[model samples]
Target: MAGLSQIWAHIYTTTLVFFSILFLELVILVRAAAGSIHGCKNRPITTTQYLKLVEEKNPACRYKTGLRMESLECAVCLSKYEEEDEIRKLKKCNHTFHKDCLDTWLQQDWATCPLCRSMVLPEEVVVNYWRHQNYQEFDGSDEELIFLLSALHGNYIRRFL
Candidate 1:
């Protein structure tokens, strides 16, 4: 009887250890699944929200250098800006346009400009045009473009200080 009792105690201890390991593995699997699904379930920012953000942040919208606000056309859509229009301004380039237009245009195209087949940076399309025109004769490659962009960013940061 004592031998039987000891056997039962050993069996119970082994079962408990097995179950604890199983429970820990299940917890890890559940956490991994939740992380992957979380990203898939979430939606990106809407176009309207993007436009409002740009309008609030950019000082360019407040005033046009010499061009009339009405004369400005979206480099992506070739459409002019209208009141309450949702638009995004390229960070590297100062081009503004309807968000929907640019989003659709970028989906199909890769490097070429939406308006012209000019080699310009995707985000800084407007500034890229000016940069290309000025630096065309300077023998600057893509690497040089990147270096110039970094220098410009540093200059912008320094001006604030």
Candidate 2:
């Protein structure tokens, strides 16, 4: 047992490093899952809406091509956008990318602008992210929930006071 103890003493630093790396990886995975709001939950965008989003791009949007110093490029594909190229401009963030490129990226559950990671929910996309957070199930729409909340708030305040 003395020989075994000596061996462990020599390798303990290596064992500690391995476990530290594993703990760090686990922390990273948990944080990533927490940040992934729509991951595996929201439905993909429709072709028509994707096309409409593509048309709403700011024509003056420009990016450096490294060759020309002034031009537009898709952040996802890193390809230069020509005059007739289809591009999608994300609102609120105003980041632009190739229509096809953004469509593919958006289909994946992140639902954010690839370049800016901003929330990019379209008007038609009705994702109630709070659906899973509710303690009680209600039979009405989100608008009704808002109306019911005020009454609940008054009851809570009166009871507490």
Candidate 3:
């Protein structure tokens, strides 16, 4: 009987220790996951500051210009932009289109500009302006120039086509 009691006590103690360790590990994991989510939410805007280094006027130019140009007719549907019309301005590339037109076009998963198939950055125009102003000192390489030109070509193609 004495030996049996000792064995039973040992089993209970070992089980308690094992469960306590598991609970502690679970608590640590939950805390670690919560901390990582908080960190991601608060991640600093280092890219915004880097963009500021190449600042020019009209950071949100695409949104503004697209709204203004919305009054003009949509090249895709040949329909006028009405105040009640659902519209979507392409990010960084300030081309505006009727939401219906854009959604239908995007359903095709085409990345080129709709009109010219050229690239446009409504926001980065400010950056390009700054770069152009300082071109003599900070001119980009030939490859960079080619890339920019190609993007411009694409934008024009979408606009005209």
Candidate 4:
């Protein structure tokens, strides 16, 4: 059991490194979940709000009588609009798409127009939402933190580290 003392030192170093890595990884995951990955600053919106936005931002309805509908193709699906097809116009860029298609696109955490890549929502709206959201850092305490913390306030950490 003469070599047992050295083993304890090795074990302590390994444990410290593991906990540090774990804490960093948890921080990364939390930020990613809040829609901060890849510099995506687009403000996320809810489905209910989208209903009002469509009408408020303005929408284009292609009323067909005898004219060719080829000019009214939805950029999203790359298909021609029919009489019953719902149309939504983005007020910013004046680009239009099928309502369902645009909704699907927005739900993917992107707030830009599919064709022009312009912001679908206004800057003020995003700013206001961001203020309310106040995406704070993940400060929640967990088992890893607890374990590392306990090791810090004396006893095992003081003796081993």
Q: Which candidate is the best by TM-score?
A: 4
- List residue ranges in candidate 3 displaced over 4 A: 1-67, 119-161
Question: RMSD in angstroms, candidate 4?
Answer: 9.2
lDDT of 1 at 129: 33
Which ten-residue region of model 2 has the weakest summed lDDT?
Answer: 126-135
Q: List model 4 lDDT by residue over 4-91, tens digit each.
A: 9779877976787678667767867886776665343465444566546645666656546464433578899998778767777788
Candidate 2 structure quality by residue, lDDT tens digits, 98-134: 7678877765544677877776764335233323223
Ranking of all predicted structures according to TM-score, beginning with the best and ending with the worst: 4, 2, 3, 1
> What lDDT would candidate 1 get against the real structure?
0.49
lDDT of 3 at 137: 23
Alpha carbon deviation, residue 117, candidate 3 (Å): 1.5
Colliding pairs, model 4: none
Q: How many backbone clashes does candidate 3 have?
A: 15
Write the residue-wise lDDT of candidate 1 on 41-151 in tens digits.
232333444334434443233223454443367776676666666665555344555666755554345433355454323344433333333443223365654454445
Off by over 4 Å in 1: 1-71, 111-161
Encode model 3's per-residue lDDT on 1-161: one tens digit a residue.
99998778667655654564565567667866776787743323333443353232212222233455633776778877665666665554556676657545543423344876653323344344433334442134655444444463454323222
Would you give me the overall lDDT of model 3?
A: 0.50
- What's model 2's overall lDDT? 0.55
Query: In what order do the candidates fall by lDDT, top score first?
Result: 4, 2, 3, 1
* Full-model lDDT for every candidate: 0.49, 0.55, 0.50, 0.66
Q: Quick one: best lDDT, which candidate? A: 4
